[model samples]
Target: MIQRFILLGEGYTDLYELFEIARTNQRRLLRLVQLDTVISGQKKSSLVVILQPAEPGKLMPLYLSLEGVYPPEEKETERYQLFEQLSHELDAPIHRLEVKPSADFNELELYFQYVIGVLRLNRFIPPLQ
Candidate 1:
């Protein structure tokens, strides 16, 4: 199976789009994740929705709002609240994880590759098949 990260910018307007994807593809929803990263001492979150692989193509989509919201545990924010509401609506619990910031990589593509590696290692998503 091939998995790809479909980033939706930071967590502002994209929050609604995220909710729509989850709601529209509820059956395909596999897992919901919150990747928490600390960048320059500021805690931020990247929300992810892992979907089942496609039937014919076997392309697994990992939808994400990359580092969009301020860390909710540190300080409350509307973005975080939006995520919470979506999770509730989907009846899917958010899985939080600590990770390196995307800025650590010189290129955004490298950052996504790094995240894919981590996910595969953790078995959050299946490896190549």
Candidate 2:
């Protein structure tokens, strides 16, 4: 199986799109994750929706909404409230994790790989082939 991150946008405004993908692919929804990180002194969050591998290609999509909202635990935000609402609607609890900020890496690809590694290590996603 091949798993890859499909970035929606920096959580600024496109988080709704991520929720839409999950809602539309409810059957394929595997995991809902909230990646918390401190970027440039600001605590932020990245929301992810993992989907089961599809037939014919076996591509497991990991939809992402990059750091767009403040950490919900630290401070309440409309975005996080919406996420909680969506999780309730889907009956899937969000998995919250603290991780290194993307800014730590020189490139986003490296950051993605790092997150993938963390997910695999934590059993949030399948091991790499």
All candidates' lDDT scores?
Answer: 0.86, 0.90
lDDT per residue (tens digit) for residues 8-111 in model 2: 88654588888899999999899999999997778899999999887677798999998887877679989889999999999999998999989889999999
Checking candidate 1 for backbone clashes, the offending pairs are: 11-68
Q: How many angstroms is residue 29 displaced in model 2 relative to the true structure, after the best TM-score fit?
A: 0.3
Q: Judged by lDDT against the true structure, how good is candidate 1?
A: 0.86
The reply for model 2, stretches above 4 Å from the true place, is: 11-13
Estimate candidate 2's alpha-carbon lDDT, on a 0 to 1 scale: 0.90
- What lDDT score goes with residue 30 in model 1? 89
In terms of lDDT, the best-performing candidate is 2
For model 1 the local lDDT of residue 50 reads 90
* Best candidate, TM-score: 2
